[model samples]
Target: MAAQGDKHKSISGLTPHEFITLNELEQIPEGFLAEHSANQMEYNDAKKKFAEICEDYGKILENGKKSQALEFAFKVIYDIEPEARSIKKVKQDKMWNFIFSSKGNDGESKRKICWIHTDKAVFKHSTNPKEIILTVKLASLLAIETWKMLIEHAQFMKIDKVLLTPSAGAIYSLKDIRFIAARIEGNQRNTTNIQKIINASCQPGGHLLAESNYSCALAAVLASTKDMKNEEVRVQIVSKVVKQYFVARKPLDVDKCRIWCQFAFDGNYRMLNNSDNDVLHKIFKYAQKNAQIIKLREVEF
Candidate 1:
C-alpha cells in the first residue's frame, strides 16, 4: 500500500496477495480501491456467505466439502495489490470459532486451540492491528502438541491450583482476554533440530511484527482458560495450554483433532523453502496425520 507510482505491478499489487484483514482494506487508496473493488466485493460477498454458514454449523470443511470454498479463499486477494514487501501485514485465520454461553454452564469444554507459527508475538492486548497470528495445517498440529507442552510447563510454574469456570468454557472473546507479551517466555528450547522446528511452529502474542511471507500461518482452535472464581484470567494461550497439558495430559486423538479452516494468504505462504517444508511435513506426520489437508478439499463453510 505504499504511495508509489500506479504503474509498477504484478497481476495484483502485492506479490502473492494479502489476507485483506480489516486494517489492510482500510489502508487502501480510494482510487485503487475503486478500480479493483468489484473483484474485492465479489470475494467479500463470498466471505460473508461463508461466515453465515460457519455460524449455522459447528465446523467448516466438515465431511470433506472444502474444495470449492478453499479455492475462493486461496486467491491472490486483489489483483492490484503490490508485493506487500513494504506494507506490514497483520492477519488472523480463525481456524475455529467459540460458541459462548451468556450464563455459565458446567457442560462447556475447553476452547479449541489454533496455534500459529509466529515470527514474533504480543502476549498482551494492543489495538495495534500489526499483531500478526496465523497458522496452516502443519502449524495446527504443532499447536496441539505445543498446547500439551504448555500445560506441562505451566503446572510446574503457576495455575495448577486454579479452578475451572462454570460456563460451557467460552474461549473468552479476544477483547476480554489479556494477551501476555513475550516477556518471560518459555525458552522453547529444544535439543534436536526436529524439536526446534516443531517448537518454533507454536506461539500466541503482543504487538507482533509481520511481513507477507511464508511463516506458517494457522489458527484452527479458539484456546483459553479460566480460574475457580469463574473469571477470565490473563494467561498466555501457550501458558494456558501449558496448564491444560498437565490436567489433560492425555495423547491427542489425531483422528478427533480436526481443523476446518484453510487460510492461504495470497499464495505467498506456498513459497516456503523446500527444506523447511520437508522438516515441517515430517514434524506434522508425527502428529497431524491428516497433514495433506493443505491441498484443496471440498469444504463447507
Candidate 2:
C-alpha cells in the first residue's frame, strides 16, 4: 500500500523531463539520444485524436441538408438552459395578454371627423442629401394616401368635415387636392395653368389655413364633443371651432411663416421660399449653420 501511494504521487507530480528520463543513464540503448523522442510522438498522437473527435462531433451536428441534426442539438441546448425557457414563456404570456386586452373600446360615437396634417417633400434640390429627399417625398405620398383614406372612412361613417390640415409647402398645399379633383373631372394636364391656380390659392384671404398646433388641438376637441348634444356644450364647441377658423385665416407674418415652412420642410429652410432667390440664399445659409450646430452637439455627446 505504501509503494502504491508513492507511485500515485510520482505519476501526478513528475515533470516532463523526469517522466521521460531513463531509470539508468548507463543502461541506455546504443541508438537512444539523452532526449526522449517518443514523448513528443505520443503528445502529437493525442492532439490528433482530439482533433478527429471534434471533427466527428461537428459532422454529427451538421447532419444532411435538412438540418435535423442542428435542430436536435439546439433542442438539447434549450433544454439545458433554464433561463431560455423562462424568457420564452414570458414572451408567450405577453403576446396572449396583448391579444386578449385589445377587445375593449373607448365607447366614443362613430360619427366623428378626422383631420390630418399633410406631409410635404421640402428638400428636393440637387444639393441636398438623397436620403433626406427620399424621406420627404415618401412622407408626402404617405400623407396624401392617409388623407384619402380618412376622407373615405368619414364618408362611410356618415360624418362630415374631414378637414385636411394645411401646410406652407407647395407639395401639400390644398391646391394639390383641387388638382387631383380636377383631373378626376377630366381636366387636361397643364403644368403652367396648375401652378397659376395654386399660386392664386396661396394668396392672402384664400381658403388655406395657417399650420398651427392649435389647429390640431381644436380638431381633437371637436371630434371629442361630436356626441355631446347638450345645448351649452354644443354652443361652446361651435364657438371654439369658429374662433380657430378665424385665427387660422389671419395671414402669418414673414418670420412665423418661415418657421412654419421650416417645420413642414423637415428643417430644410432652403426649400422654403423658392420665389425669391435672395431669401432662398439666406435660408440656405441659416440651414447650413443650424446643421453644423446639430452635428457639433452630437459629437460632444
Q: What is the lDDT of residue 171 in candidate 1?
A: 22
Superposed model 1: Cα runs more than 4 Å off: 1-50, 53-69, 76-86, 89-301
Q: What is the lDDT of residue 43 in candidate 2?
A: 27
TM-scores for every predicted model: 0.16, 0.16
Task: Note the residue pairs that clash in candidate 2.
Answer: none
Model 2: which ten-residue window has the lowest total lDDT? 93-102
Write the residue-wise lDDT of candidate 2 on 1-301 in tens digits: 0011111100011121221121111122322321223322332342233222222212321112222222222222222123323544554211100000111268642211111111222223233111111122122222222223333433444443323423223223433434433442335332232323222232222222122232223222333343566846554553433333333332213343343333233323333333322432332343344432111112110
lDDT of 2 at 288: 42
CA lDDT of every candidate: 0.23, 0.27
lDDT of 1 by residue, 1-301 (tens): 1122233211111111121121120122344334334333433343333333222111222222332222222221121111221232544212211121111267653221112222223222123322212222222222223223332333434332211111101221212111111111223232122122222222221001011001211211222221223323322332233222212222332221211011111212123334323433443343344322221111111
TM-score of 1: 0.16
- Candidate 2 is scored at a TM of 0.16
